[model samples]
Target: MKKFQPQPGFVVQAYKFALDPNAGQGAALRSHCGAARTAYNWAVGWVTASWWQRRAEETYGIGADELTQWRPWSLPALRKAFNEAKHTDPRFAGWWAENSKEAYSTGLANAAAAFDNYAKSKNGRRKGRRMGMPRFKSKRKARLACRFTTGVIRIEAAARHVTLPRLGIIRIHEPARGLLDRVQAQAARILSATVRHERGRWFVSFQTEVKREIRRVTRPDTAVGIDLGVKTLAVMADSTGEIREVPNPRHLDSALKLLRLASRTVSRRQGPDRRTGQKASKRWEKANAHRNRVHHRVANLRADALHKLTTAVAAEYGTVVIEDLNVAGMLRNRCLARQIADAGFGEIRRQLTYKTRQNGCRIVTADRWFPSSKTCSGCGAVKAKLPLHVRTYECDACGLVLDRDDNAARNLAALAAAAATGTGVAGDQGTLKRVSKPRGADQKTRATRPRRKAGTGRAGGAILPHQRQTETRDRTQAEALTLW
Candidate 1:
């Protein structure tokens, strides 16, 4: 029998470490990160400028290969370009060597990737119609990420030391816990290493290719459906009737006052004037750093919450079902945008999608257009109109009234179950929910509204008993939408 060759798997993870780098060490890392950024920006400018003057003549048009010869796309070519430009251009004079080479490499890598993507799109091989050039990254958003190959990154067994190219030897925050053992066993190979600085701390990340023993199935029969929203990070319903709630972190909201104060301070300071060749005042710079630190803390907190939630769900469920949420589109709604961002709704789904793979769980993505909220969980009675204001779902034909979101969650759970059974319905089934508004509780339906005989709506939503409903009447008193 042929040996079982497990499918290729990857683990791209970042870990926090308590790195107390000396002043010199910290400066060196910063320089390298800056160099990478410079390199990336330089390459983007060069390629774009070069392409600007040229014309597309051939049937195949100008691709990365042809343009690479006429331009600098490879690392060596990019380095050479930066070397010449560093001195001759005057614009970048005395800027090279002082900063890390990684910074320069970043720019080149970005431009190269962009060009390559365009080339793929031009050939009609890429998905979603076509692609665009990778936009250049801004300095304000630049993060320290250094890529080092095998010879550039090495581990010393006896001393537990790391020897980076040019940077020389350094100590790891923690011992390479059994890393060498795995390497010796031929289970892992170091592909690349990156050192980053964030939250006033430094960390080294290794991108390795590892061969692992087959992961056995633990709970193949278990499946789950996860519904993500702003009020709660997620309302997960599983085959076992368990509904897990991961509350929103709202990190930004907590730091809002601090952020506002920082912004006010920054505004009052003498900011930099680019045209006048002036750098920001020391005070301004300090204020900026303070603001950034707060932002970083919020991010860290949010990430922690999400990872915990997703990890739990992935480990507990065998087959996970999640709606293909359009987070970007949803963000357009200003009222919910901040809440959604704080909730990290998109991030939760993303984490769940990937973690399930590691936990012997299959992720079933419900279609984006699928109406998991409108349809009745008990019977397939889809409502024609569901408003955002309505907290409860009441099926007229079936006479089922339940919490709107809960009802939706139940429908999603049922849909996931149906799909797993290999017998499922696709597309919208006239599924609609009551138009819910965020307001006072006890939103009993208006008396004027004719109540259809019972047995339509099933499952519950986020209604906490005393939910409100809009009051619409035809008389001269007007449509008073007073909550109950």
Candidate 2:
């Protein structure tokens, strides 16, 4: 398949709107998503059947050349096989034609990607954590979603409706005048549309290639460093010696009482029991929905706050510096995990990344191990350690006292200055510095004891190809830094 390349001066973006479908349309949406799931499951089963058959044949002393042929998992292969069997296959024979083919294609695409990832991970070609074989998705657990890459996909002239492939026109909760105007003016072209059921509501997201006008920052000569934390959401210190703080909203903490009440109500109701094949009562469903509403609202509030904060910072500063925080490791601390997660440290950096690009500004990411808080902003003196309990930073060498967050923010701002001037400042090298790997880091821990080799299984007590272990690389190795 050819990769999509947007025209020069244009970028791909998604515009999402809340959908308000009628009851019949809602059922049709569910049916489409279910069709996708069905297709995905069929693909998995067909491909794995050969593996099971080969294993059985080995037990019977059959040669490898005589084993059952393996089924192809590529999209075209799966589509062709599905087309041939749909009329006779008991699982999908009766109602497979009700939903659009794109729904099934979406599922097949997902399954193929899952298999590809697993293969890459197994062969040591993929990064991050190792992936296991793809498993069947449970109907109750799978998210309801479908994508339309072809056929009619458009935002209506009315600005309050959208037309999707096969789904037809559906009303939306909010006006899409911005996207509609862009399309009418030939400034944007819709590439695809995805409908998803999430957080007790339906949403349609249109992927489009948009021609964006580049804009200058509010303060073109200024650089700001943002120090994110649980107590205060952000402490921003600019190169001009001005400091600002944004307080953490703690949305989840504020709504905990209501959430607890909702949870208790759900617990008292007759919920579904998969083991006993029992369905949930109407009251249980209602209570569960109420609990979900609270969670959804909290998520929405967090997203809105982060977007506003990131946009303001991106628009104001020519250069934004933020730390590469170890959020995954921080979550292991049970006492502060909830608070840290609620702060959205990772999300802030992610939003700033693209926002800065769009605003014609740049972003600098400090090394994760950089001692921003331990290094004194004044006199460039480094402290051995700084405990979390000490909110005030008192530099022993320079007699400079300042708020810990403010001091950290100042140090971060110095990094941007160092990069700009091609000189070290406040102990920060112009380029990112490498540090030794610390114990109890976010990555997989090294084994203390000697590890055993893969053991033989059913066939002649020999280790299978899939069972061989792959070597892991050191992720803390030094690398060149580039501005974003």
Candidate 3:
């Protein structure tokens, strides 16, 4: 029942507000976005051309040291190179100064990060999915976004308008009182502002360093576990033996028909053809907008539901336990991908991770391979195997019958105690344990990939210590030894 202590200094936070711009202002915003895209495309082309030149030179039997050096993709190097070329380069010579310099910097910064990630992935130093080389940003496919950091970015005293570097004062669709109040009280300082065009609307997000008050949970001694699924968005079980279920809203499923109709309408209309130089019809644009609106609505609904659920849990419970689901792997199942995506399993855990930390609550993530669903909550007996079709968990040893999700949630709840003690059992499974703590794992260890033998694929790398040992013996031999 330990309480969280207040941090010594401020924390960086973002405040995003929708914008309402005039026709002329919208045109200017689009111009800046285009400028950013142009700069990013130029950088990619320049770096790629340099690479091809070096490769071609090597093909001519040129010495390795004699070949032209490859151009670096770092931001400083890109900026210096662009500065020298802008005056003579026909592409950017005419109206490059129309937009703020920060626009170009934003693009260059993104390019640098992209190349860095690709290099890291090539060396097997980066985690998650591998990143490819940076490509030219297309006007039609790329998201329109620009960031301003060195210029005057501020909110007006009235909280009705915002001022950017070159964009000038633009009216805000929503009130900005929350951010304005903090700034006026000397509790926050704006660091940067990014303008983005999404779903046919413009939004400005301010990154600020703000002083947040330390929050306390309502029930400091209470602990609860969350079991996330498609049918029941979340099944909760608390230490008090009380269970709660939050029904899935199925926002995407509910709007699937509308989305399909809108998509069909768009497909029927005369859309833009870049190859043939054909412009999109007005009707096509309207239909495409309708389709985008449906998608945006679904995303907003899911985010709202997740926020409400996470807020309630973080504010009330002192310790929250949840399973570490392999969402990416789970989504590979074509049959359940749609339903699983609609459930927002990853989003739920993401929101909870931050909310719990902010509200002074602890989050315990059970190992991904933990057999929560295959263990008896009543007596801790581990089942040999449990299939997804088994909705009800019937324990043979303890004679406990309960809902599958509910039993998993209860087991997750018990993990908090096991985690605290480090050596305790969850149900009857003495060997069931967690690998990481609530905060996170060791950064040094987690950041480095495991070493593998030469000629072995990634799958053949070292396995986790908790995994069941494999042998050449048959199932009968393994069972016989267990009985003895």
Candidate 4:
């Protein structure tokens, strides 16, 4: 991303270039990633073995300097140590040592960083529980090539596609138009480029430190509040009362049949049992890979959709308002997990957060309990309860019957002004909506049902109601339905 300091304007722009590495380059990059993985595993084993021998369960005993002497954690250190113990250490030999220096560096960096993070957390300098020594990532995990740094990593102008320290130059999939053109004209210097293979494809993301251009907005006074949901995706309520819908991509349905077929194939193939220390057959591995491919495809589809939605929203809105969703809490509800994940509600908000800031826009977060859903967007009257099935908000006071998501979006927009001017509590969003009145008569409503939250369980069963419902539904639809 380029920042314009000289002109002092509120605009910044950045580009991500896709890499097209050759087969050899791909192999080399994989080699480094593999090497890094090996080194990481080796380091973990060494540290664990050392600790076991010392019988010191506490990570405090193994200092960083002491770890440096252990070898296999770093290149320079490992090479020197490797020379001395070429015949002594039975873990690995010449072939492993021939791997990229980056691999060893990765392991050492990972371990050091993990240890430091743990130390900081222990001293209450960071969040999360007190962590222990870094555990080695398994070989089954996908290899990562892109490395993070303070500055944006960019490609060199002369090379167009620069070679990494260990990985060779690979072609860029994209025609590095604006960025490359700008850099070649002495406007920008390409700092670094890293090629990464993720979800069955290779992509090169470039980070360039360049002179930022000043941009003036045509619609200077425009603002919008976005309320995200599982059913509607995103509802944007602008100051001009324009409401837009970005529908959730339920990719699971499209890929489910194929995924099921893959799963069946995997099951048909005799798989290994790790309890018996059995390795998987070639057929099983292939089937598993196919299954993974399906999962990857679904993930890729979701990513593409989110990217487009966020990018468009950022360019349009001057001030964005969104809710601070309790994704973790929502995930705990087994009934809604699938739908919520499909919507990618958290991802939408997350993208908006940085994108708006980058696009010279303001982002306002409504309190979790601000009653965006239950509040009457027309009259500002808050409600106590609104069931998930109730997709229309029927306000008794204002007689406003609107699309549930639209109403929520409008409510979010208004809440932004309130939130900006006042200090609101940061807790569950349930407290905001004091009551929700359905269209039913007051006496008729009171006779059968008492007041309760939308997700409230009327029957506090020893087992959840959804669990019973699921069992019954599964049995009823077992023959008719296919799950993937």
RMSD of each: 17.8, 8.8, 11.5, 15.4
Q: After TM-score superposition, what is the CA distance of residue 63 in candidate 1 from its true location, in Å? A: 21
Local distance difference test, each candidate: 0.65, 0.84, 0.82, 0.63
Residue 36 of model 1 has an lDDT of 76
Candidate 3: 10-residue stretch with minimal lDDT: 472-481
How does candidate 4 fare on TM-score?
0.71
**TM-scores of the models, in the order given:** 0.73, 0.86, 0.85, 0.71
The C-alpha local distance difference test score for the whole of candidate 4 amounts to 0.63
The sequence of per-residue lDDT tens digits that candidate 3 reaches over residues 1-120 is: 133233466888899999999999999999888888888988888877867786799799998668665566768889999899888888788999999999999888888777766655
Off by over 4 Å in 4: 1-23, 42-92, 128-132, 146-161, 214-218, 272-289, 419-484
- What does candidate 3 score on TM? 0.85
The most accurate candidate by lDDT is 2
Better of 1 and 4 by lDDT: 1
Ranking by lDDT: 2, 3, 1, 4
Clashes of each: 41, 0, 2, 12
Where does model 2 exceed 4 Å of error?
1-7, 422-484
**Per-residue alpha-carbon lDDT of candidate 1 for residues 280-353, written as tens digits (9 for 90 to 100):** 99999999889888888999898988888887777666777778777888889999888877887678777876
